[model samples]
Target: MPDHAILTADAHRDLRVNTERSAASGDAVMSAMVVPDELRQVQNEYPILFRRNLEHDRFTALAMFGFEDGENLFLEGTRWAARYLPLSIAIQPFLIGRPEGADTGVRQVHIDLASPRLGSEGLRIFEEDGSPSPYFHAVVEKLGMLDAGYQASIGFLAALRRHDLLEPLSLEVPLADGSTHRLVGFHVIDEERLRALDPAAVAELHQAGHLMPIFMALASLANIGALVARKNQRLRHG
Candidate 1:
């Protein structure tokens, strides 16, 4: 259960959050939700795939780290091997919150009191003078970027849907030990449809600032091979 509390300098002045990269810190996951804005950096390290939220009738981008649940191949003991950690993964134990019955569109920072990251021996949220610490500011920045990117992703997904550029993706990975893993229920940008799009359609997507991320998502598929290699290496060592 999550015990969420609105963050305030007085209440959380001495609060410290562990910054370790490990399974105990909640870094052991197969995938994390991603946004179009971060797709450029994400493409370099992880395969980008789309999954549908049936309840919300929406599609969300994902940065895949492994083939199964709770299996983070990029995580080596306490270290994450990726050059760039996705913002969604970096922003932990903190979430954007809205006050009840408020229509001002103001956002508040909420901290999970039950998070394992909350302890007495990590980064302080506030200084002795009750001001936000540098680490707090960085977390806020990541939260802001994540919030804005989530909003922008709506338009990006709409553009993809409008042009019929999304197609189902099913992957089969055969490890060196002859064990096979299959991943399904994901979608990817349809390169064939994108290539067949007329000039005017492409121009519209460009004007809407969705073309770059579309291409980045397509390019991210190349990392799938690397992910397979990591799985194989893990299997060989064990």
Candidate 2:
């Protein structure tokens, strides 16, 4: 976002705790809260960004990239950790039945989002050395990418709407360790009304021409209530 069109605030309520790093950085983790009372008055002053899972119908997420429990991904200065609905079907090529230590680099190129040229071929390295870590492999074997994008969009909306953007909400998570974290934050997204962002941003993104293939593929994949599977698969989220 451009500096002129942005507002910065401190928050800690909903950021998801990264157990992987939390072990070492738990004491370093800081938190903030999005002031709801401050939001109601300024809600209309900015464009509202509504978010929804291209796959799941129940809750919608903002478009910001960061932890669900914390303020900004920049705080940790690492790759983002997020979830989405359509991602299950979108990333099947590299995630399914593949060995460990695999990286497709699908996200490295800007155009990759709208093209079919995804990650490097091969399995990813399994980082198990008898030590249980907090970092878990977030695989869809299916997809949650598009929903992630949608979620980010929602985040943008919230940031624009109120000075306080990050707030805690409930997430019905099923952890691998058989232990559940209650009251996980899933930021708010107004499913119905969202301001239309600058079309120029998308136009500039695709101006390169090479990135066309992936979004073209995504266009077909993102459909409402769309369900697609591997081999015998079909598109689900719209």
Candidate 3:
């Protein structure tokens, strides 16, 4: 559980966050999360797919970390190997909160007071005069970008659904130890369907600036093989 509190300069001026990366600091295996604005970068490192929210019955974009739960192939001795970390992973311990009884459409930043990352020697949230620090400003900017990116993703997902371009994916992988791993309940862009799209629909997607991301998501499938290779390497060495 997270001990969340609205961040204010007056109350938590001296708060410092630990920027270290290690499992002992609670940085461990991570599952896929939605990232809308990082399709190109994410495609280079992680396999982008769609996952169903069982409760909501809605599809969400995911960046696969490992073949199974609690297994992160990107974890290399506490350091994530990927050059591009997902926005959801990078924004840990802080979340955008809605202000109480306000209607300006502004979101407040809330920090997890009990996060392992909180320490005595990291980025300061505020200066001695209660002014926001540069680090805090940067985090705010990032959060803003994250918000806009995810908002844009809503339409992107709707368009994909409109075109029926998502299809269920089932993967079977053979490990080095002569064992097989089966993965299910995931979806991917139906390349055939995408290619078969009517020209007018393709033109509309192009006009809407969603064509490239679709291609990037399709290209991200290649990373699944890389993930398998990393998993195999870990199994062999460990």
Candidate 4:
């Protein structure tokens, strides 16, 4: 369980968070939830796929880093090997919260005291004068982006569904060790359907600001081959 508390300079003046990229710092993962806002950058490094949330009965995007659980091929030693990281991965141990009985529109910064990244070293959250440090501000910016993206995604996904542009994706990935991994329960943009759409439909998607993200998600599939190469290289070196 997480011990979440509203972040306050007076309560946590000396708090420092480990910014290192490592499994010990909780960076190891097969995938990270992503939003359409970051798809332009995320497409360059990860395969963007959509996942269905049964409980919510909605779709969400994910940036895949590996084919299996607990595996992150992007991690090379203590450093991440990508030029752009998903906002969901960059913002850790910090989340936006609202005060109980207050307006739900109000956003406040909250910190998890039990996170492994919280330690005596690394980036400081606040200065001695009780002001937010540069690192803290950067994190808040990411959290804001993530929050806005999450809200935008509700509309983006609905547009895709309305257009019948999403389809199930099943992949059989073969590695150097003669083993095959089957990827299931993931969806991708149906390029065929997208291309077959009428001009009015295309205009609607473009006007709604969803066309580019759909194209970016299609482009991201190219990275799957590179991700497989990384897994093969890791296998060879090990």
What does candidate 2 score on TM?
0.19
Cα lDDT tens digits, model 4, 1-238, are 7999999999999989998899998889999999989999999889999989989988989999999899999998799999998998899899888899999788999998988999889899999999999999999999999999998999999999999999999999998899998999999999999999999999999999999999999999999999999999989896
Residue-level lDDT of model 3, residues 1-238, one tens digit each, is: 7898999988899988766666766666546566567888889998998987889867788888887767788777758888987877787667788888888577889999988888778888889999998888878887887788888888898899899999999899999989999988899999999989999999999998789889999999999899899889989998
Candidate 1 clashes between residue pairs 3 or more apart in a chain or in different chains: none
At residue 127, candidate 3 shows an lDDT of 95
lDDT of each: 0.93, 0.27, 0.84, 0.93
Q: What is residue 83's positional error in candidate 1, in angstroms? A: 0.9
* Stretches > 4 Å off in candidate 4: none
TM-score of each: 0.97, 0.19, 0.93, 0.97
Clashing pairs in 3: none
Model 3 residue 140 lDDT score: 85
> lDDT tens digits, residues 1-238, model 2?
1111111112111212222222133212212211222222213221112233447533332222222344332223332222321232223222222124656433211111221222232233123342212321354311234334443434333343443322334444333345433433344332222223356643543463312322222232222112111101211221
Worst-scoring 10-residue span by lDDT in model 2: 1-10
Q: Over 4 Å off in model 3, which ranges? A: none
Number of clashing pairs per prediction, in order: 0, 56, 0, 0
